[model samples]
Target: MPETLNVQTRDDFGKGAARRIRAEHQIPAVLYGHGMDPLHLTLPGHETALAARNSNALLELVLPGGDSHLALIKEIQRHPLRRTLTHLDLIAVRRGEKVQVDIPVILVGEPTAPAIAVVDAQTLTIEVDALKVPESIEVDVEEKEEGYQLFAGDVKLPAGAELVTEAELLVVAVQLPRVDAELEAAIEENEAAGAELGADAEDSEGESTEESADEE
Candidate 1:
């Protein structure tokens, strides 16, 4: 079920207005989709933030006049340093309607001994019901041996969901971790070069002292 939020229409515009709205513990947002004209709205900051925790959260926005619309978070802008919500762009959606979204990929269980599972793709694009979008899609790596590769097509998606990503796209790879011998050798060579330079500097200083004594 979609989270319900009471929202208000706003006529204010520009950065100044947005800041003022945020100062009042509200979020500024715009809703656009389905060929409708864009609607400027103000949403409660705390409620919207909680719902946004799930990237593909479906929200039912209630207007002051009792009209409501279902919306999907299309984009979010945040403060770079503070990580606070700055603004939002929403797209109107309907329940049961299919929407293309990027769902986070989660790896579950461990691979075979000496083999580690590495995620090649962080998210998978899928077409799923807007109201039924999942929080994440889990990929099983249990007992996977080294050199095992899982592609997007191998992923099992939620019921009725369709994969939009290329089937051949790599999602996870199980491999044995090994150190680079060439890199290690280069580091050792550099250390040896520094030690030789130090010895040459010390010998040069000793000769200078001996010459000073001879002059005496």
Candidate 2:
């Protein structure tokens, strides 16, 4: 679980103002929801970046009136080349309130045999208390035999957690190797073809040389 990040609101907006905010080591962010007006804000750039490094980060917004609000980091815009945070959107939340969010999926364990784990679903959307949202779910695939397909229903969630995703959805599948055998066969065929071509070239050169010698 990640700790709450502290943020302060900003009054400025737009492209040029956002650029200046970044140069001042603060990130531009917007907070909306609860049927209220959107509040523009600026967060400490370094702390914001570090907190977002982890998935499903919980943020604490400290408003000007000494009031603190809990929020979830919704969307983040970044510079394409520099990879710096350009803007962010935050959604306010209340404690013990269930919020819909997508948590990351982590695979664990190795499947026996040459099998591929096909992940049909990468994230699981669930309702959890705003203060207790999980960052990710760990899927144990260790020593699983081939042809073992794990579904969303098969995931073992942590305590106090509920699944909001459809149980029938395929989360992962350990199937028989799909490409190794074919790739090896193709390589062998290519090598055989090259050998035959080399032999043919040598034979052609020998015949030409013999013909020239006889003419001489």
Name the runs in model 2 displaced over 4 angstroms: 1-4, 113-118, 176-179, 199-216
Residue 154 of model 2: what lDDT?
79
Candidate 2, residue 183: Cα displacement in angstroms equals 3.3
Off by over 4 Å in 1: 178-190, 209-216
lDDT (tens digit, per residue) of candidate 1 on 7-101: 99999999999999999999999999999999999999999999999888899999999999999998999989988898999999987789999
Alpha carbon lDDT of residue 67, candidate 2? 84
- Cα lDDT for residue 12, model 2? 66
Q: Write the per-residue lDDT of candidate 2 for residues 145-189, one digit (tens) a residue.
A: 787888888789877788899999899888888688899999999
TM-score of each: 0.90, 0.84
Task: lDDT for model 2, please.
Answer: 0.84
- Estimate every model's Cα lDDT from 0 to 1: 0.95, 0.84
**Residue pairs clashing, model 1:** none
